[model samples]
Target: MRAVTWALALWLALLGGAAHGAGRGSAAEAQAMVGKAVLYLQQHGRQKALEEFNRPQGQFRDRDLYLAVFDLQGNGLAHLNPRLVGKATGDIRDADGKAIFQAQRALALEKGRGWVDYKWPNPQSGKVEQKSTWLEKSGDLIIMCGIYQ
Candidate 1:
């Protein structure tokens, strides 16, 4: 019985570590998405970049990691969420009453690129969860991609 318990605990420990590693991998992949998107925006210009970002079946849409672009004024220029596109998000708040878009925009503008953490609805799970988004300033737009944690 003691050996069985020890084995089970070891298995659980390894499982937990694997999960943590997977989470880091997802974040890294999301970061890469943002970097690739910045390059795409820089090379193609806003119109084409927005079109590609909004494309449902395009390279930008990778599972839950999708590209979003918001103008410095906090207006959605390109988003996977159809309801958000062309909407003013300057005052949009998360579940914690944090002005999520404003914070992201400010960080992108202030630092030129960084990550912002906020509560967001995870589409796959349909639940509000902790999310971290990587932001990059592409001219007048703040490009982003997030990972749910």
Candidate 2:
């Protein structure tokens, strides 16, 4: 009975550890996908860039991916989500949205790349969601990508 109890506890602990590790790995992979996508956009320019963003390929489309391009002054230029192409995401003004935008700007200036995890407001649902943002700088433009993990 004592050996059986110990074995059961050990199995449960291993299972829990595996679950936690899996979650962390998934988040890291999502982050990498965002990085790759941003890099691709930086090298390709807008005309050829939209094609990469249009589809949910491999691990990218596994969750919701949002990409936006902005000028240095924080004005949104284009978005992967066609419906929001002309919208002003910077003026979103809400604390979370503003912070994410600011972080993206900072990253572009500092390392030529930036990333942060935050909760974003979903326009359609009006609900807040946990997401990760990746920013890359290419000449005069900044490309920002958000992945809902």
Candidate 3:
């Protein structure tokens, strides 16, 4: 009985640790994505870089993805998603939206990299979606990439 109890506790602890690790790994990946996009834009320029970024990777289409760029003053410059283009994403109001924007701002101001999870509203169904955002600062510009669920 004592052995079984100990085994169960150990298993639970391991599971919890794995879950935490996975979350950390995901945030790291998101940060990397931001860095890659920034580097691409810096090296390739806007049109060519976007073309390459949007190109289908494996099974994903660039149109089905979201990317945005902002100036240091938090004004949007461009967005890969036409719908979001020119919108002020920094003042986003949803709880998750706010969190994501805050993280981006902090990264832009301090680390030059940011990652956060948030909810995106669906256009057709008016439902909120879970999403992750990655941001990186390049000179006076901030580039953002987002993955939605």
Which candidate wins on lDDT? 1
lDDT of 3 by residue, 1-149 (tens): 13643353345344542432432223334445567777778888877765665443511223224456777666666654454455666676664436456567776789876454567763333578655566777877777765443
Q: lDDT of model 3 at residue 72?
A: 67
In Å, residue 32's CA in model 1 sits off its true spot by: 0.6
Instruction: Name the TM-score of candidate 1.
Output: 0.83
Q: TM-scores, in order shown?
A: 0.83, 0.57, 0.56
Number of backbone collisions per candidate: 0, 0, 0
List of clashing residue pairs for candidate 1: none
CA lDDT scores, all candidates in order: 0.78, 0.56, 0.56
**Tens-digit per-residue lDDT, 46-133, candidate 1:** 8898999998899997667788889999889888888899999899899999899888877877898877877999877789987777
After superposition, the stretches of candidate 2 with alpha carbons farther than 4 Å from their true spots are 1-25, 54-60, 77-80, 95-99, 122-126, 147-149
Worst 10 residues of 3 by lDDT: 56-65
Let me know the TM-score candidate 3 reaches against the reference structure: 0.56
Q: Which of candidates 1 and 2 is the stronger one according to lDDT?
A: 1
* Highest TM-score model number: 1
Question: What 10-residue stretch in candidate 2 is worst by lDDT?
Answer: 17-26
Stretches of model 3 off by over 4 angstroms after superposition:
1-33, 46-64, 95-100, 122-126
